[model samples]
Target: MKIKNLSLLVAMMGGAPAIALASGYHFGSQSVSAQGTAFASGAEAADASTIFYNPAGMSRLQGTQFSGGLTFVLPNSDYSDKGSTNYLKRPTGGGDGGSFAPDIVVAPSMYLTHQINDQITAGIGMFVPYGASLDYGGDWVGRYGLTKIDLMTININPSISFKLNDHHSFGFGVSAQYMNAELDKASDAVTGLRMGAAAGAFGPASSAITNLINAGAISGAGTIKIKGNDWGYGFNLGYMYTLDENTRFGIAYRSAISQKLRGSANWDFSGVNMTSAVPGRFRVQSTAG
Candidate 1:
C-alpha cells in the first residue's frame, strides 16, 4: 500500500503541464523520444532532450550529451462558405476560401547538456515554441476577418541543475523568446462610408460618399496590413526526486511572458478614388516595446 501511494504521489509531481503557454499556437513536441510517448516521460531522465522537458533530468546524465530532431507538419483545411456575413451582418459576397493552411512546415529542435561535476549539470536548448502560417487571399468571403496571417517564435533556454545527495534534484532555467508576425485583412470601404454618412463626418462631401457607393467603387477599396516583431523573457523551474533506482518523480513549470509589439500598419486604398481619399492609406508606426 505504501509503495502504491508513493508511486501515485511521484506520478503527480512529475507530470508537467500538458498544455503550453501559447496554447493553440504552441509546438509541444520538442523531444523526439518524449513525443513518442506523448511527452509523458518528463521524469525519465532520458537524454539531453530532457533539457526541454525536465531540466532536472540532466543531473542524471554523465559527460556531454546532445540531441537534435526535425518534425514535418502537413496541415490541410477547407473553408466551406455556408453563408458568411461581414461586421454589419450583411452577406459577404466573395469566393469560398480554399485550403488556407500550409502544405508543410518543418520544425527543428536542438539541445546540449554537459556535466560540470557529479552534483551539477548545465544545458541549453533551442526550439520553436509557437508558429503558424495561413493565406486566404484578398477576395475571400471572410477577407474582412482575416485574409492572411503568419506567426513564428523561437525560444532559447539555458538551464542548470543541482543534485542534493542521492535522492533529490532541482533545476532552474531562463528563457529568451523572440516572435514575429504579419497580419492582413480587407477593409470595407462601403461600410465605413455609410458610418461616416450617419455620423455626418462627410459634411458637405456626404454626396460624394453616396456616389462612390452607388458606383460600386467600394468593392475592393482598401486593405489593412500589420507587421511586427518583439522579444520577451521568462523562466522555468523543475524538481525531481528519486525513490529507489527504478522510480523517480518530476514536475516543471514555465512562467508566462508578455511582449508589446513594435511595428507599422499600412493601409492601401489604391482601388478607391485617390483625389477624395482622406490620406487614410498611409503608414502608421507604433513606438511600443
Candidate 2:
C-alpha cells in the first residue's frame, strides 16, 4: 500500500451566525491528500490524518509519525442592492457593496501518532474545525443589517485506538474547543429618527437632543457591537473494518456541545443609552462520517 501525503489547506469562512461557507463553519481542509479526492476516501486511513478522519485507523500506522500543513484561501463576494427600501419605504441609498469579504485566509493543522503496542495506538491532533468572517462597507445599503462579523475556533483532540482483530478496530477521543466571535452593524435609521422625534415632543428641556439630531451628532446612525468567547467539550468515536488491503470502511460520530457565550451588545448612538446581553446558550453539533 502507498502512504498518502496530506496537503495543506486554504479555506474560506463566510460570515454570520449561520456558517454558510462549508458545512456549518467546517473548512474541510484538514488533509491535502483528502482534498484531492474531495474527501471521498478519508476512511482508508492512508496517512497520519487518520488521527482525525478515523482514529481507529491509527492502529494501522507503524512507528511514530507526524504531519503538519497549512491552507491559504482567497474568498471573493459582494452585495448588490436590488431596490432595497428603508423602514420609511424610501430607497435605501448606497452603491453596491464591493467585494467586502476577506481576500485571503490561512488554515493550519497538525497530527501525531504513536504505536503503544501491537494492538493499541495513541495520537493527538490540533486544527481549526470551524470559523467565519465578513465585512461590508459602512455605506453599504445593508449596513444597518450587518457591517461585519468574525468567528474563530480551535480544537485539540487526544485519542486512543485498539485493534480487536485484523478486520476490526475501534477508537475514542475527546476534544477541547475554544471559540470567539465579534459582530457589528449600523443602527437602524428609522429607530434613530423615532427617538429624535420623541425627544422633540418632550418640550423645551429636550432642545439639546433635537439640536444634536439636527446636527447629525445623534443621527441614530451609529453602530452596535457584540463580542463573546467560550470553551466547549465533546467526544468522538470511530470504528474501522478492513475487507482487504485495498478496501476498507470506517464510520465516526462526534457528539454535540453546548456553550454559554457570555457577552454584551452595545449601541453607540450619541444621546442614546442601549445595552443587551447575548448568547445565553449556543449549541453546536458535530459532524459525522
Candidate 3:
C-alpha cells in the first residue's frame, strides 16, 4: 500500500522546526485468503491458514492440510525539509532525503494442520509479524536523527484445537519469535574531539586539533551504527462459537513478546584522518538493551 502525507514528527530542542516523514512499521496481513476482506474473514475457519488467524479453525480441517504464500511489501518514504536544523541550530545541510524505503519486501507464511481425532486438531505456522527497512544514505539533512534502519522478525507457532460440541471450539498456541535490528546515524565529530581534548588524550596536539577543525580540515561529522539480535517468547489463545451452520462468533488474544538485544555500537569520524595521529582512538563499544 502507498502511504501518503504521513509525517513522523521529531521534537526539536530550542524551537527548531522538526523534520517530518512517513513512519509506520507493522505488517499485519499474514494470510492471502483473509486479506481481501482485510482479515475480517479470519473467523470463517475455511482453511489451514487459520492456524495463524484463529487456531480453533484448525478443527474444521478434515485431514492433513498445508497452506503457504508470500506477501510483497513496497513502501515509499519521501522526505520534505521543514526548516530542519542541527543541534547547533544551524541549517541542517544536505538534500532532502530521497526515497529511502526498500523497493520491495517479501513476507512469507506457511501453515500445516493435521486432524488428530474427531474432536482434536494439531497445527504449526510460521510468519512475519513485524518488519521495516530504510536507508536515507549518508548525506541527508536528517542524517543526525536517523540515516538508516533495518528491523525484521519471524514467529513460529505450534497450536492445538479442541472441538467441544457442535457450537464450541477453543485453541491455544505458544510462540518463539526471533528479532534482529540494525540502525545508523550521524554523530557530532566536533563534540568527540572536544571530549578527547578535555580528557587530555590529545596531549600536546590539542591546540593543533582545534586549528584543524577551525581551518575546515574537519567537517564535524561522524557515523554510528548499532546492530543486535534476540529471541522472545509469547502465546496466543482463541475461542470460536458456531451459531447454527451459517453463523459464527470468535475472539482471540495474543501475548506481547519482549526482547532484550545484546549488540555493539560502532562509530568513526568521516572527514579527517585522525586514526594515524591517534591509533585506535575510535573504538566500537559493547551495548545491551
Best by TM-score, which number? 1
> How would you order the candidates by lDDT, starting with the best?
3, 1, 2
> Residue 203 lDDT in model 3?
71
Off by over 4 Å in 3: 1-24, 194-208, 274-289
Off by over 4 Å in 1: 1-24, 217-219, 273-289
Any runs in candidate 2 off by more than 4 Å, and if so which?
1-25, 193-220, 270-289
**CA-lDDT, candidates in order:** 0.73, 0.67, 0.73
Give the clashing pairs for model 2. 7-32, 7-33, 9-70, 9-71, 10-71, 10-72
lDDT tens string, model 1, 111-133? 99999999999999999987888
The C-alpha RMSD of each candidate to the native structure, in angstroms, is 13.7, 12.7, 7.8
TM-score against truth, every candidate: 0.84, 0.75, 0.82
Count of backbone collisions in candidate 3: 0
CA displacement after TM-score superposition, residue 243 of candidate 1 (Å): 1.8
What total of clashing residue pairs does each candidate reach? 1, 6, 0
> Which of 1 and 3 is ahead in lDDT?
3
